[model samples]
Target: MRKADLLDELRAEIGAMSDKYSSELEKLYQFVCNSLFDNMADYQWVSIYLVEDFSFCLKFERGQTELPPVIPFGEGFMSLAAARGSVVRERIWNRTEVYVPFYHGHHLVGVLVVTGTAGGNIDDEDISLFCELASLFESKVKKCNS
Candidate 1:
């Protein structure tokens, strides 16, 4: 599909979602993974990592058996997103990495990482959608923490 079309579709999907419950956030994460898998068709793994105590912890994951242990906010792609406060994309020999930062007001919350086969690439649209989703997740987390 065209990049614009993919982005529009993602925006529509995200707009339809309601982040009123934690379960809804889980569903959103699953939806993102499924959408990425369907659209790109080369992802081996997709996961959501949230900030906790200045670290990024795996919250949900798909297509992977084991994930790295809790990661600090200054390490890995997740940390890169948090540190840069922006989306980071890179292509590896066997995998593609994408990280989108989550923000709560001015505070950095966490990041969402999507990894796919080398043939698949993460585009600007994917990064935007991931950041939007992360913002929703951050909002929900803030409400719960309050």
Candidate 2:
């Protein structure tokens, strides 16, 4: 499916999910991650890191490999995105990665980390879509808390 159509479908699914299952934020995170990986070929994995005290904890992930459970607020791409309040992109271990920070009413809530498939580079379009998805997740988080 095209990117726009995919995003529309995602939004619809998320809305239905919210109506049907008023679960925790982590469940929503996992659903988004899994959906992105399953629908977007460029992405191999996705994870959500939430700010916890002095560190950003890995709250949910869906991928082939596991990420560290905890990372300092200033460390790594995801942490840096949260700290800087902007998107961060980098290439490491032969894969392109993007980290988009999630904010809820000016409060930095978490970061969404997306990694490209092996041997492939993440393009700007993919990054933009991931960022949009992060924003959707952020809105969902805000609604749940409100």
Candidate 3:
């Protein structure tokens, strides 16, 4: 699917799915993960990790391979994403991975990770779109905590 169309459809699905989830925030996460997995083939997995005291914990995940349930704050490349305070994309041997940091104002709230690329490499436009999605998650995170 085209980027704009995919985002629009995902947003629409999230909007329509509010009743299915506990909140709009959860609907966003659920829809995005399922939608992306359905539409984007190259992406092998989608996962969201959020801060829990001094570490990041897995809030949601789907697709191949297994992810650690917890990662200490300021540790690993996930910390790099937190440190960057934005989207971070890097090639990991055979596959490229994208990491989107989620924030609640100045606080590091969470991160979204997608493994693999659209093709051989990820597009800058795609990263921009992912950041837009991350912004949506950020707002939801803020609202949930408030």
Candidate 4:
């Protein structure tokens, strides 16, 4: 499916979903993971990390391999994303990866990381989609927290 179509479908699905804050956020995470994993064959891993005090805690993940439970606020690729409060894309051990930061109000929430599979590479479209997802998550989180 094209990026535009995928985003439109996601928006529609998210609108139809109704639940409590945490539950809805978890569902959103799962939806994002499954949707990206299924729609973008090149991507083999997708995760949502929640910020806790000064650390990035793994909230949800779906991929070919597992991820660590926690990472400091300023460490690794995820840290780079949080540090800049934007998207960071780089090649790590041959696979292309993109990390995006999520924010609620003026506070940093966490990060979203996506990695390519095998020799797969991430493109501009993937970055845009990830950014959009991050924005959506941030908006929902802010509303929930309020």
Candidate 5:
């Protein structure tokens, strides 16, 4: 499926499931990770890293391999995006990086990192959609926690 179509389906699913259960945030997190891998075939790594204390730690991941030890709040792509409150995309010969900020109101909560081979380089449209999904995920997490 095309990326737009994939995102549309995800938006629909998230909208439908957002308020249905007490564990909806966890379900949303799982859905985003699974949907991205299942629909975006180019992605080799997908994970959600939530802010804990002063660091961003991997809370959920999927695809070919596991992520590294930890992704701190102000390190690498996660830091760049989180600090700027925007999406960051990079294309390296063997690796591609995409980071989308997760926010709760005006506060940065975490980040979603999707990495893969160079062929998986995400474009502006993909980043925009990912940001939307990340917003929903952040909102649900905050709501559930509060």
Candidate 6:
């Protein structure tokens, strides 16, 4: 499917899911991660890192391999994206990692991280779709937090 259509589908799914999984953000995160991985075959994995105190914990991940459960603040690509306060895309050896941070006011809520195979570097259109997904997730998070 084209990126635009896929995003529209995801937006609708997330909207319905926001109602169904309102109290369990982790389940919602897992669903989004799974949806992205299943819909976009090129991805190596999709995961969400939620901010807890001073660290980012692996909330939910959908992929072939297990990811680190905890990532310290100010470290790794997660930190880089958080510090930059925007989407950060980097080519890490054989993969392209995109980090999308979600914030509520000035407080960090979490991050949505998607990594795809090296050749699948995201262009402007792809990144825009991702940013939209992150925004959708962010709205849900904000509603729950409030």
lDDT by residue (tens digit), candidate 3, 11-41: 6675466435535676568677777777666
In candidate 6, list every pair of residues with a backbone clash: none
Candidate 5 global CA lDDT score:
0.75
Q: What is the alpha-carbon lDDT of model 3 when measured against the actual structure?
A: 0.75
Ordered by TM-score, highest first, the candidates read 6, 4, 5, 2, 3, 1
Over 44-72, each residue of candidate 5 has an lDDT whose tens digit, in order, gives 87888888888888887787544565766
Q: How close is candidate 5 to the true structure, as a TM-score?
A: 0.82
TM match of model 2 to true structure: 0.82
RMSD of 4: 2.6
Candidate 2 CA-lDDT value: 0.77
RMSD in angstroms between candidate 6 and the native structure over all alpha carbons: 2.1
User: How accurate locally, in lDDT, is each candidate?
Assistant: 0.70, 0.77, 0.75, 0.78, 0.75, 0.81
Model 6 — which ten-residue stretch has the worst lDDT?
A: 117-126
lDDT tens digits by residue: candidate 6, 36-57? 7887767878888889979999
Q: How far in Å is the alpha carbon of 97 misplaced in model 1?
A: 0.4
Better of 2 and 3 by lDDT: 2
- Of candidates 6 and 5, the better by TM-score: 6
Backbone clash tally (model 3): 0
Candidate 4 lDDT tens digits, 1-146:
77567667765664555233344677878777877777777888888888897988988887865558798776788887777788999887878888899888778887888989979868886687788778888878877778
Quote model 3's TM-score: 0.81
Over the stretch 1-146, how does candidate 2's per-residue lDDT look in tens digits? 77668767866786677556454676777787888778777777888888889888887787764468898876777767776778899888888888899888888888888888878757776777777777777777777888
**Candidate 4, 144: how far from true, in Å?**
0.8
Consecutive 10-residue window with the lowest summed lDDT within model 2: 14-23
lDDT of 1 by residue, 2-77 (tens): 7778678767766666443355566776676666666655566777777789788887776762448598767777
TM-score of each: 0.74, 0.82, 0.81, 0.84, 0.82, 0.86
Question: Which stretches of candidate 5 lie above 4 Å from their native place?
Answer: 21-23, 65-67
